[model samples]
Target: MKKELSAIDAKYEAQKIAFGPMYFQAVVALRELGILQFISNNRKGVSIETIIEKTEVSEYGVTLLLEAAEVLGVVEIEDEIVKITKVGFFLLKDEMTRVNINFMNDVCYLGAKSMTESIKNGKPEGLKVLGDWPTIYEGLSILPEPAKTSWFEFDHYYSDNAFPEALKIVFRKNPKMIFDVGGNTGKWSFACCKHDPNVNIKILDLPVQLKVAKANATERDLLDRIDFHPINLLDRSQEIPQGADVIWMSQFLDCFSKEQIIQILENACNASSENTTLYILEPFFDNQDYPAAHHSLVATSLYFTIMANGNSKMYRVEVMKDLAREAGFEIVETYPLIGDSYHTILECRKRA
Candidate 1:
């Protein structure tokens, strides 16, 4: 019993010592392997020699990386041959994979090193780590070569996964038209069209984002039914496109202040008709004692504020109802969308 306990204690102590440095070393190895880009280009698998040659690293370094990757199940090694695993293939194939890598490498990794400082300060130094770029997209734009490609990968991941789920929950029945607010890349709009053939989507977003949205819509064969409208939310005179039965705000409102949210709500109210319904799907903050809830709230809330100049506060269900009421709308219902977040539908009628 004493021998077993001693062995266990030693193992725990060793883990404590190795954990931090091992994680850091893994990041370095990833960068060295050109893993993100290699996976993106090949999508099959690349040998250690190929990685070493492409990344201009030594054979010794490549071997180390291959070993580490095999251990992490990122790569499979047999008979001195290496191949990407299923998870590895999925990560590389997904558009947002690279973007996520860049985010982790540039922002999260560096910021995590100073986690103690952030904990003490009660905020992240994401802006500082990200440099001159204001938004996540802007930061991604300036990334070197393959890293930029990774950004596209990341964008696709969020669009492919999050938007579809949100749209399905929000627009179960076919609607004639949908105004997708902050509809970058028009993924959600495309999703709406996919869900219901009769649906027409109008995407409202920043000019650059609108350009991307248009391209994405075209690629998805949804350009005919989807139109892009360039409008800054801060511009009060900006007209909200009308004749839409659904006003979709998928992953949008969280990127603003209370006043800004109210303004947007008012605009949505004005744009909506008697039969129009406003849909909002976003991460819901649950005041639960569970670790998952706590981690999500803390991590996401901090991320929005520091990185995007936005609030990640999970708005109360009542808060939305009150906002809608003030803006001449009545709450229909709020329910959990497939995952951790909530979906809210607000029905509006113009004041008499």
Candidate 2:
């Protein structure tokens, strides 16, 4: 391990931590004001005068934002010319970064203010920023504008890319019926139908989400192959339907607390027969290859706590496996690092 920071260095680090939100806002301002893009287009570095003239922002405003960005290392000012750095490039053009920035700014930032309250009360106190709901999912249908856009984009970003490979795994046995739990927008169910014409899908989710999912399937002329079941799995009174040869949950379990996850899994066990296979896809934090991936997963736990639900988190592989066993399921296979994605597939069956 490296040496601990000296008192002076520690103070500097603490100041940076205290100013974290301001730093993020500066980055956003740089992008919003078109200064980063202007410098990026010039490439040879643009003078403050030129940026002010080009973007039409006041010189004082431009200078203040760029100066802050220089400290953040997203830009550099040398010989009075500002140049965009690699970090700036990621902020401007990287898809993941773009999605993350928008998601944080639009979906999580304001609600995050209620984090302390959420933690104290074991509830999504931050969710008040959007609407009055126990969790974000109930409010997803009504979430406004770019917040809605960013939310779905962030949600799909981590799970969508894995579908092609996961489809292969799900269809390996050519199951006749697949139950898609938490089938948001019906993307997976549509993919399932296109992958196999003979297979039909049952989508189980909240009524609001089911309405959207059904509309999506109808627009694609795929509704005939997909059915909808609107139920709140969080309610212990609700039970998953039976007769699905395959039960599918893609990036779904992380929305629930550990106890809730076990309860849902147990309900799934009741819905399953010996021949049924339950495929769970998750991006377990510890199973990630990169430290950044792990960091993002852990940070997302707070989002769940403050915005989504009060108790769920991006779980570790061992913790999830234990939950599975507790729910009377036996893991038949574990497929890690599924196809250029940070997801793992657990193939499970009912316990004997």
Considering only N, C-alpha and C atoms within 3 Å, which residue pairs clash in candidate 2? none
lDDT value, residue 266 of candidate 2: 98
Cα lDDT of model 1 by residue, 1-352, tens digit: 5555588888877885677558546745665567645644654556666777787878887777667767666777666656777666655554334455564554455445544554455444455565555455445435554545644554454335555556656666667888889886666777778788888888988887787778777787776898888888767898786798888776677666567777888887888777777876654455333554445445555555555553334565567567667766666766553443333333444454
Q: Write the per-residue lDDT of candidate 2 for residues 1-352, one digit (tens) a residue.
A: 9999999999999999999989988888888888889999988888989999999999899989988999989988998899999999999998878888888888889998889998999998988888888789988978987799999999999999899999999999999999999999998999999899999999999999999999899899987889999998878899998899999999999999889999999999999999999999999999999987898889889899999988889999989999999999999999998998889999999999
| Cα RMSD for candidates in order | 7.1, 1.1
Each model's lDDT:
0.63, 0.92
Q: What is the lDDT of residue 349 in candidate 1?
A: 44
Off by over 4 Å in 2: none
Model 1 alpha-carbon drift over 4 Å, by segment: 1-102, 110-125, 128-134, 137-159, 162-173, 287-290, 310-327, 339-352
